[model samples]
Target chain A: MRTLILLTTLLIGACSAGPQPIRYGEDACNYCKMTIVDQQHSAEAVTLKGKVYKFDAIECLVHYVSPLDETTFSHLLVANYDNPGVLIDAKTSSYLISPNLPSPMGAFLNAFDDANRSSAVQREMSGELHNWQSLKRTITTRNQIPN
Target chain B: MSRGLSLILFFFLVSISTSVGNKLHVGQDKPYATIHSALAAATAGDQIIVHSGVYRECPVHINKSITLTGYGMPVLDAEGEKEGFIIEADSVTLEGFEIRNTGFSYIEDRAGIRVKRKHISSFRTTDYITLFFGIYLEHAKSGIVRNNALHGKPLGEANSGNSIHLWYCADIDIEGNLIRGHRDGIYFEFATECRIRQNISEGNLRYGLHFMFSNDDIYTGNTFRDNGAGVAVMFSRRIHMLNNLFHLNWGQAAYGLLLKEIYDAEIRENIFQKNTIGIFTEGSNRINYVDNDFLNNGWAVKVAGGCEKNKFHWK
Candidate 1:
């Protein structure tokens, strides 16, 4: 009984779900078929079954998840534009579409986990700010490649 | 009359000087201390010879029509900070140099050697390492990128670049290049009328030769081995694939040659050996698969839906 309990606990611990680090040069983006090299603008999505999908840019994450059911994914994370390689929650994050900041897949989108910090950057860079749904609508409406 | 005579004399002297092709030498012991100084002093139709040394510089922009040749294989190291050379002018011939370490950038697509304008050019580079893109050709036409060897050791989870990247270019020749350990060995997007021949592209992290939206291209006599995925030609038209070898590309979703949304391609006399899928086609139309050998692949030809009028000539 003790061995069974220990084995179940170990299996559950082994299968624990979280965001894996985006290997910049190694991992390929699941959406746009690019190598996920950008640290500041990449993103990740975790399904309810614990399957992780990585993207090279924030817009790719939005475009990929836009048509899917909302209940499919348990967590959606975007890279903090201020902090390179740091993944933050996508639902609560604020987005800034600044032409001054270019991304890997050419969406001109930047994400910040903090709203106040995103607004401050917007003040400095002088672009539009958006929430999750607005950003998704804007990204899906327009084409992906701008150049 | 005297003023006209003097002006004619000046023009005669300038023409004679330029036609003679002055040679500027750059070395530690030569007249010029740096290649930049030599380039600044050089005019059009001049030849600048760079001697053997490791020179750390970013963006050695060549704006004049000149021949920049290296003696004894000089090294231009960017130190993972910036690009190596940005060739702007036409009729530029760059030969015999080792360019390495064009550092990674998130905002910009940096390269070891970037051919910007890309008309009537010749680039013969030796080796490159740890770069985002090895040789990038943008808006270029009628150029030859030949006999270059690029070896990349990519950083952890950082975005890796392609070895030879061509964007919106046309009528270029990519020949005899040995590329390994990149995202894609040769990548072409919106490029047209190009020829990729006699190149060995192996062990890349993505497709060995990945081209999209290119038309009227010819790829022949190349060896693509052990790449993450093999060659992928998507959204292209009137391409010719002849006498190439695709071997040992194995993964769950990998293929020897993947064709998606392609139209009117002639694929002839190629060999695909030991891959997960030999030829995976989707939405391809009017393609002729003639004399292609599939040896020991998981699936010889896995046809997805929406393919039309593909003639398979079995030899």
Candidate 2:
């Protein structure tokens, strides 16, 4: 009975340390100097020592972290526009950015974390989430979009 | 006896001369032979007929002047691993070939063909310089590329390669070619006094034809359609565009043609239709847009705040 109680206590500690919603940004984006809105197009980065720093845009995040080794970032999270609550990996995530997508920076899609979320949002927005291989075949190319 | 000896000598000489000129045969099943070797062994203007097979190699450096023709559509594989065909000599012709599968990287600027020289009149001083491009012509005076097809699958902004790229080339003729799936279908960076005619570019991610910092060039009778962004002319001067069709460049902010920081150009008798935006101009000065058609586009032209000293005449 005592061991069962101890195991339950450890599980609670692990659950408590799950990603805290930390807010970060300058007074404005370093690139465009627009007022930083934490809920929209913000950045989240976890360091090697378990510290998270936030920024308003990926551009700002890149500028801020320049000269610092990129390998220091452990976990990076950006907002998922489709399902508001979820955050996904930045490097692997697909983007549905176009001139028509509607953002402060003209019309373009920003950071997305989840593939399922990206797919859901792409379907909602009538767009397509192209994989790296297939995306190569479609855009930035000199051949026909294969049928 | 002397007559027979003379006849035998004559036949031997004829056979030897024929074998000397015909070193490489087109449409033959051979492992691989260097395009350079075939050109060197060939006579001054002999035709080096390359067959219809995937010649899985590149940096196919051309240093001598010759004619290299491929049977059907030969595939020249850069393997997406090295820069495609590089031309260093003069008076060479490449035709009836399909070049594809480019290697992607953030560091290297890979292209299907790189022309390394700026196109200028023979008597002109060398004060003005243009950036080199695909089908590159560096110090090369005269060349021609016709009836060839080029396709590249570029991924992301970094991986995307340019098709039919040219630079520092002069008096060149590019006719009846189909190019698609690249950063720019046909890019002329610093080429001057050149002519690009009768080509079709479609479904590219960036400009169908991108010319930046170039001068004194004539582009006519070409079709640019369904590109990610239609066309861009930046920091260039003295251009003449006529009898071209720009259509179906539909995206949120895509334009049929984008003129930025250009000067003293003539854009006449061209058609722009079914694009999200017809012409987007910024800081483009002292230009003439005469007798051009802009139909069914979202916005005919948008002068985004930074324009000065430009003229647009409708006839």
> Every model's DockQ, to 2 decimals?
0.27, 0.02
Residue-level lDDT of model 1, residues B1-315, one tens digit each, is 999999999999998876868999999999988889999999988999999999886679999988999899899988888898899999888888888788787657788888889576554455444467899888888888888888877665256788999887989999898998888899988789999999999988878998777889999999999987789887678989999999998876578998877889999999999999899888889999999999999999988878999999976
Error of 1 at B43 (Å): 0.7
lDDT of 2 by residue, A40-78 (tens): 455566766566665545434544555467677777665
Local error of candidate 2 at residue A22 (angstroms): 22
> Which ranges in model 2 have alpha carbons more than 4 Å from their true place?
A1-147, B1-23, B26-40, B115-140
- Local lDDT at B306 for model 2: 64
Candidate 1, CAPRI quality class derived from DockQ: acceptable
TM-scores of chain A, one for each prediction: 0.89, 0.51
Task: Give, for candidate 2 chain B, the lowest lDDT window spanning 10 residues.
Answer: B123-132
Task: Give model 2's docking category.
Answer: incorrect
Best by DockQ: 1
Give the poorly placed runs of model 1, Cα more than 4 Å off.
A1-42, A48-60, A81-84, A92-131, A141-147, B1-20, B105-109, B118-132, B157-159, B213-215, B235-239, B260-264, B283-286, B305-309
